[model samples]
Target: MRTDRTARTDRTAPVDRTVATAVAAAAAIACLGTLSACGPDNGGDQNAAPGKAASPAATSPAGGTGAGAPQPSAGAAKPSAAGSASAAGTRDIPAGAWIDPRSIPLDATYHWPAPAGAAKSVAGAPTFKLQELCHSKLSPDTADLGTGRAAAQSLAGAGGPDRWQAQQTLLYEGDPRPSSGVAQSAHAVFSDLREEVKACAKTAPGATVKVTGPENADYFAATVTVPQAGGNAVTLHEYLTAPDGTVNELAVWTTGKSGAQPRVPWVGPADADVAKAMDSALCTTLKDC
Candidate 1:
């Protein structure tokens, strides 16, 4: 199996395009015969403030009605003293807080195949807020929510006609204070993402973005289609809040054949599947779900 390895950097800061060139080159080479272009970057940040609910919207270049996305549920399980510390000592993240990569469903097709081996762990870094998802602009209040413990994994397609990549991140905020404190912080991050998606649709000229799910839903999905010379690059970004105040992000990138539209599957596993997996991974150490 061919592998493209690049130097690791701080995930908290904006992604450096220079460092991403190697991965991009790998993707381009993988799609040489079937597709003329490669997909977009796979790095991302998860942070935002609580806002209003979001309205369901369709594919359009003029943006969608993502007003106030769903905030963190007040009824979410809160972390306890025992859950906050391990046998050794207090920890930023309790054991088993990170999601299991194998649990996530993959969209393996002839054009875009899934990775053969298990996902590889990237560098861990502090969590920071983003101004929008499409661009790498950082929000002024990036530090307002405070830093959270973060871990990420990257998975590349085995060897397919069309190159593809997937990234998964777990951001855990273990504020032992009551429910409101932690819930509010998580909700804020979700809200920011909702608004950023809307902004990306409006500002990006040749790009079309569609956001799905109701305003009150705990999880929402967004798809961005960027027109390239020979084909279009499509990306699916999905977000959801875990029962224990952890933010789970799944991003998939794929490209279409020349003069064709990309047809990658929606975000990733169903929201229910992700929630169940996260519950099993997090509830053991964070709180009783």
Candidate 2:
């Protein structure tokens, strides 16, 4: 159960205050709903999984290329039309259509340490949700994409609870044509996100959300910052890319300590860098390049 401090309002406040408060509360509820469906359980031991141990030098915050550093995918298999087509005559994103964990770009750019261990495969449903933008009202059907088949990987960070990253690829089935239901849903979700960001910026106080992408591009990056009491804030940086019937999302979370402002020194990858990384994954691993 995640809480957004910016949404809290006094019960005895004026009617206008109540109405304004509802916006953030609604967004928080929507986000929590989505998290319940898609987000990972951050409890228990994060590094308890027994497998190949991550090299300490590679993941160190000093940021150096080493054996444990994430490498780019080389000669990944491209999906075939026959293999991806389902019995319903609709395109299906294959289970293997995931970006190579080693290929994920993690460097000093984000000013954060790499995963403390090798990537762990995630099970069950897709784990990507576009929350915080208040798009729940735009299209109720499109609010959460966890209903689809998915492939995901999680990287657990060392040190504190606030450090971690996740990458997910969702597979939705629909007509293979350009005018397919899957394509339409993808377009509508992105469109609604842009519209909601603009509206949220106007209505929500002490919240900063920015989105950027090339015109007509199949990808976009969003950074959301919600201020809390005591001069602290939480920021989430997410990059989403939709190619055909597949949607890939990479997201990271960071929190500010003391009176530090999150925006002054960003804690995640640059919009352009992460955008290029997602595009590269799509072109190299999942679809035809």
Candidate 3:
């Protein structure tokens, strides 16, 4: 996450504590349900895979993020047939409501859920970003940028536990800092970021987080949907900024789809407690980064 507070809403913005609190509650409930439903997929383990853990991508000497650009489409979406596209005021897109960050492999095939809302966006097109939404409830509103939750280490050593066998992860051997810490500012920053994300999700239909480009910069986002918004399939993006402030690695995900898709929000809102825990974890792990 950019240490820049300027990219976020002001503390004095129209905050509705009560409403936000309620949404936070819903978010917690949703997490429980989701955990129960997806527990199997979580592998119940977080150990690094056997062999050397993948190193975060290296930063370019030019100080530019080296993320590869999105592949271009053959041509503009063919104009809809006279009667195929719904008239204005429609709520969602046609059958494939999902959004594939236009960066799919040329030979890849993607599938998206049928759009359920109106034929078109009521307010505007979805803002597909690629921040870490793994730890947030309000969906893609917030990021998991090298904050919150220390990267776990194996007692045996790098990839010692094997991500398949242990719930703990392997930290970069070259990096000395533990994934967690005992700092207050980090915790405070995490709490603040979570709160802001929760508030933003209220109005946003859905959001996405992406690693800021390929290599450098504090962290960047895809304000508007573009072919460059990669990892739309899994709808998950992880940005790893080197301690030196350069984003060295980024991961992206989204439900595979040819065009836009639907956001399967958690059953309830994201849990407020998660924010507290995440804040503490992040603060504790990365005090100064």
Candidate 4:
């Protein structure tokens, strides 16, 4: 396949422009995406005096909601619709939407944000966040896109004996806007990233960037390399949009420096795998795609 490569200087501008807008929109869907926290312990007596000995009565109150009292049956608690939806896992993903996971590399261990430790390894250095690979720019301000917890997913793999590491993820932003608005918003983000890639080509001096387009007529791929003192890393980013304004992104990057074998082999999915994932019914909400 043909790969369009270039170098660019400015990369953070596109990210800054949309962060404020996207974060603002984040408030709207925060509840939907946020995870539940562990509730505080109820073992302590609320009315106990500091440094005071607890009276026998305080230790065990009759008919109180304490551990000593007869506990309420688990059946008494109510289940929330949101909790149920998240547990279902298929909330946005339609049946048979994903390519057979078997087709992906056998060693690829699917992780939500790659391995957590990978991020902490390169402190005080020019390390890249996984978000940067997918979210280059924010969706349109007026676009009602939902960035729910269930809306994002990722996978990581240890490259086979090559010390290469690969990671891929998808961001499903559900847009509640009308067709005109949804189309405009999706196109806006895509155009923004395209322009950013082009702009980067001219500025990054020695860095190498290859941009390829309209994959399956629905996706775009960009490969970037930023040269540094010791060695540089290569990152492959893929972007896709569904008819219902759901945006899917896929990325795989090397963990090792340029010219050296990677320590962890990347077993993440390939461009074709990413395309298959986007084609699946990811984020197919009721009455939406």
Candidate 1, residues 1-289, lDDT tens digits: the string is: 1232222334423556666877899887787733433224321221332122211111100010011111112132222221222332222233344455565545434232222123222222222122223553324563343233322232445534345555444444433233455565556655665566666655555666676555676665655665445455444445444343555555555656544544544346665566576456556544524
lDDT, candidate 3, at 236: 35
Tell me the tens digit of each residue's lDDT in model 4 across 201-249: 4555465566655434656666665444455554444344444443444
Go through the candidates in order and give each one's C-alpha lDDT. 0.42, 0.42, 0.26, 0.36
How far out, in Å, is residue 214 in model 2?
Answer: 4.0
Cα deviation in Å at residue 132, candidate 3?
A: 16
Q: Would you give me the overall lDDT of model 4?
A: 0.36
**What would the per-residue lDDT of candidate 3 be over residues 1-289, giving only the tens digit for each residue?**
6545654655534476767888999999999988986585664433332111222212101000011000011222221121134332221122221112122111123221111111121111111122233222322432222222112211111121111110111111112232232223223333333343334333333443332332333332221222323533233323222232111222223343325453432121122222222223222332223
lDDT tens per residue, model 2, 1-289: 1344434543345777878999989999998987776556533333332111111111111110000111111132222232222332122233234444443444343333222123322332333333432322344665443333222333333423344344343333222242355455545544654555445545455667776556556567776665656666666566666655344566665556634553434444456666665556445434422
lDDT (C-alpha) at residue 94 in model 4: 23
Candidate ranking (TM-score, best to worst): 1, 2, 4, 3
Best of the candidates, TM-score: 1
Between prediction 1 and prediction 2, which has the larger TM-score? 1
RMSD of each: 26.8, 26.9, 29.0, 28.7
Off by over 4 Å in 4: 1-83, 86-155, 158-172, 175-179, 202-205, 214-216, 237-239, 259-273, 283-289
